[model samples]
Target: MAPACEPLPVQLGAPSTADPHARYARLREAGPVHPARLPDGTVCWLVTRYEEARKALAHPCLSTDPAHASPKYEHPPWEHGPPQALLAEAAGRHVLHSDPPAHDRLRNLVNRAFGTPRSAFWRRDVERIVDGALARLAGRDEPELLSGFALPVALAVISEVLGVPHALRARLEESAEALVTVGGRPATPNAARAAAGEVIRLMTGLFREKRAAPADDLLSDLASAADEEGGPLDEGDLIATACLLLFTGYETVAYALCNSVINLLVRPDQLAAARASPALLASAIDELLRFEGPGDSAALRYTTASVRLGDVDIPRGECVLVSIQSANRDRCRFAEPERLDISREPGDHLAFGHGIHHCVGAPLARLEIEVALHRLLTRFPALRLAVDATELEWHHLMPLRSARSLPVRL
Candidate 1:
């Protein structure tokens, strides 16, 4: 093997989101860790195997904060537009990018307002939103599932939870699409900046509105804390948290739902089994996540100190990308990992991640998926792809797997 200081010639530019699993399988088979160069010309360690990926995710030295990055780490692997500093200034102070006490404080506030119990409480709202979307889909001759049904349902539920009025929901969705599609499409730098500006403008106004007239919603609760001395949030924290929620809350859920539907639709037996029993459907959710979760990897992690993962040694101040999708499908960890077995035991999947930074919205995402899938399948018994499955194109966004558009014949 070459010296740890020398990066391999192989480039892990962007995994083809449509069929990333085959590539991840090869990487995992080769070894647990590989030195790779990203598209932005950054050399980093990519963790491919299950055990190493899980440990790396929770490793103390692997930090999510950008401050821990090496001085030479110029470009962020995920985004191209705007300097990392500018993006950080706009939306980087949330729980996802902190450590220890600060992360605890921010996460605790989210949990208090949006925990499992709170997510369960939103079931009625989710069902109502999903049913309404399905109704609209029913009217169209050939509906685009991602935008027409899934995306709208996900956005509406989250908007209601955040106390966003009906008037602002469409605008919120547009700005969010702009922010997330940066990597997926060829977008100008200003696209992200403009979208960020719009989000900040709307959120700032909403924060003020919420403070003046508190409501029984997550935003109101967060805004209230920001008003107090030594409270959990400040203006920066609130805005950043809002960005985090807005981007992840709806986007990830919608993508996962689309992915799940695609998976089930292709496998007639799984679809039949899922529709046959609600209990089986619930168990199948994790299987679907393990088979093809929305995110291919967790957030980019930086090494605070030299660390050994498996047989490879990585130096301090370097980048580490852990493939959550690869880990979930590791044959060593899961028997017959490639097959989509809905009856397989559900725990230990890294779809929502592991450790302290595990997605706070797991419960909510799962709830949305269950409600949306159940309603969708029951509503359209003959639902099928409008075009051949092979013709569907997927977004190239790393860590996010989504079809560009899902056309369905209902």
Candidate 2:
């Protein structure tokens, strides 16, 4: 008979210190699952192991509905308020936070837009976007990688894919930042509300435009999907899905690109290796995802019923936060997990997550990051941080983890 694993000791209500790696490591070593406290003082389970984390994420007992769970678990501040009408109109209609069936339906419709043929078709467009963004950074002694390259590349690709108006792209970017900020750093109540309004307004306009024109973008596909069998998702659902895609597509991939560039620049040998052989670029990107992919914490999953994981018993409606950052670093899963080895193939990292809710835009993200990195490295051989690495600050309290700025000198 197999020995029962001991219950992990968990720290509930831990302070929001800058780095929690020490505490997280302790929890991982003790057991696969443990109890933890959220910023709003709510208690939940934190899953760390590779296997358990995968099971917990795919478990049917876990629900993604914010309403059934604690209000404190809301991502943006507006989620807790009178629910931005546009966002509410779109939430359940999309797959990001929906359960099966509805999730399946919505995902199928959107999947058509991201199919192999469509993705292959977009390769030329993606390259154009990447080249244009990198070109702007060329011949400069110092370039703000985050603002000058990564952000723009990601924003352009996603915006163009969704057929977002070029002029409103900047506004959408601001709203996206504000949306992430509301759930992330501490902000004044008014500031949070204002950011939420901006996101709601931007998405509302895009939804209206898609409805009118029905172009060749993802938004149009979604808008047209409403007539499909299973009853079409309403305006709110459409808006919510679009907003969610924009936020997920832009923020996470942008940060990962910045981190990957920093990683390669710091290790010239790896950069040289990647340059000599382009095949290494994919592996290098995987390493970066394992080392510093965004979403330091996993998406919140609420328990639908009482369930036992290891020695811990999670109650119904209890929030479970999977630490992708921690899981990626689990020693049992990856050898020398702490070290960044560009040549080493990471079997599978949860950076894109696991199960049904895994990132839908991953293929697109991979293509964008790969192209951006290849061009940035090939174009600027002397790329180095313009500012001290330690001086850069990460966006605290945000579910998506990334540096606020990455200043680089070519």
| Residues 1-410 of candidate 2: C-alpha lDDT, one tens digit per residue | 11213432344323243555555576677777876655556667778777788778788888665555755555522221222323454343446667877677767777787773657767788889988887787787877888677877788898888888888887777755554432234346565456657776776777777777787778778777767676767666667777677767776788888778777777778778888877888657778898878767666778878867766788887788788888888888899887778889768889888878878888888888888888777887677888776676666453556677788888
Worst 10 residues of 1 by lDDT: 79-88
The number of the candidate with the highest lDDT is 1
Tens-place lDDT per residue, model 1, 334-398, is 99999998999996999898888998888888889998898888989888888888887886556
lDDT of each: 0.79, 0.71
Off by over 4 Å in 1: 1-9, 13-18, 74-76, 79-87, 116-118, 227-232
Q: Let me know the TM-score candidate 2 reaches against the reference structure.
A: 0.87
- For model 1, the local distance difference test gives 0.79
In the order shown, the candidates' Cα RMSDs to the true structure are 2.9, 4.1
